[model samples]
Target: MTKIAVLGAGSWGTALANTMAKNEQDVTIWSHKAEQAKEIALKKTNARYLPGASLDSNLKATDDMALAVQGADIVLLVVPTKAIRQVAKQLGTILEEKRQQVVLAHAAKGLEQKTHLRISQMIEAEIPAEFVTGLAVISGPSHAEDVVKGDLTAISIGSTDDAAARLLQAALANEHFRPYTNSDLVGSELGGALKNIIAIGSGMLIGKGYGANAQAALLTRGLVEIREVGKALGAEGETFLGLAGIGDLIVTGMSPNSRNYRAGVALASGKPLAQVEEEMGMVIEGVNTIKAVVDFEEEFDLDLPITRTLYQVIYEGKTIDQGINDLMTRPLKAED
Candidate 1:
């Protein structure tokens, strides 16, 4: 059996642990809280993040990072993006006794708010390249709640190393949960990160009583903005049109279960972003990713009007009506 260590016991992390254990892999999950570990180990449940779901018997939970990762063939980092650096730092100290040949995969999606670095870059910075072996980011239309319920879903696995990517593809692909492999790490990672911002826009549209036409327009235009940034960053344009890009946008933007979408709806309902997060009890990645997109636009000289307006609405106290009007008034140009 392939030994896999999954860091973080949040919903998505727990869902992945369940998936891997279902595959008969030896899966261990690390949680910072001893109580969380105890819940999973004893009751086989992660009530806080994934209620009503029973974890697989093959899955073990631990608070000790070293014990969770000890002699694992693969390590899956599933923590929130903000917690990634600290987790990687701790892993560095604990994995010193382990061989450097382990495959590293992460499921988190977002760029660092202050540094504008993607999760992959942050991991590369914190973990040695040799031990890193290769990196894979598994993402797409996946909701932790849906996965825990055993609903069918599809995701993309991206890496520069084709062989390593294929290895992950084999590990994660299943009858209900499919995994597609791609080499465009930049496009896949950026697509996953940027879709959260668009999902916020979608929620705002719904909150404001916009019909399906407006929602479709926002989703399409959002893809355009994502593609523009991807192009500026040298990502393959076609990748944006694929599973990790448009597919992810459609699911996240439309689904109420998406944390980003919920965050947007809360914002549209006149609640402060912080208050919304407090009520939701989960990390809304789009809130931070929107700031990162704003920074990227300024740094790269990209004209992402949708992103700009969204940023203003979220950060600069602009009204939703004002933001929509600003987007509507942009000079007409030929459709690309």
Candidate 2:
């Protein structure tokens, strides 16, 4: 049996931990809070984030980091992006002290707050190579809520190392869950991160009572912008056309299950960005991603109309209508 340690008790972590348990894989969920970990261990339910879902009785949860990482064969980092490096650093220490080489896979789907580096890149930078045998990332259209409820979900694993990706694929694949592997790290990471930004924009459109036509237009154009940006980052254009690219985008941008989309709705309803995030009690990745996009766009001298407009709205206090006007009235250019 493969022993997997999932760090974090967030919705994604709880749902996936349960799924792994259902698959009869030995899974342990670690939380920073003792109460949260205790609650999961006793109740088999995470009410705060993943309400109304039953977790497997065999699944284990704890607040002790050492217990989670010590004998783990696979350490799944499911914490927020901001917490990733901190956890990885701590993990590195334990792995070295105890002398364990584990495969590291991540479900976190945003760039580093400061460097704009992908989650895998951040992990690589923090974790010692001797402690890590391989690295992989999991991302796609699957929502945490739906996955726990046994809705059919298809997701992708991306890695430069194919053997590592296949390991995760074989362990994760089952009747309700499907996994595909891709060798393009850039495409998978960009697809997952950039979709959150576009999803927020799509949510803003919905909150403002814009029709489906406008929302559809935003999604299509957003893909174009993302494709260009991804290419500049060394991702292939064809990658954007695949499941990691367009498939993830459609679900995240259009689904109410997406936190980024819900955060956009809150923003459209006149909630301050800070207030919205605090109330959600979750990392609104799109909000952070917008800041990263603004920073990186200047570095690359790229024109990402949708991302830039969302940035102006979120960071500069521009109104939704104003942002839309700027987007719709940009100087006419032929579709590339």
How many pairs of residues collide in each model? 0, 0
Error of 1 at 179 (Å): 0.6
lDDT digits (tens) for residues 80-172 of candidate 2: 999999998988888888999998999988888878999988888988898888898888888999999999999998888888888778778
The TM-scores of all predictions, comma-separated, are 0.97, 0.97
Where is model 2 more than 4 Å wrong at Cα? none
TM-score of 1: 0.97
lDDT scores for all predictions? Answer: 0.88, 0.89
- Judge candidate 2 at residue 114 and give its lDDT: 76
User: TM-score of predicted model 2?
Assistant: 0.97
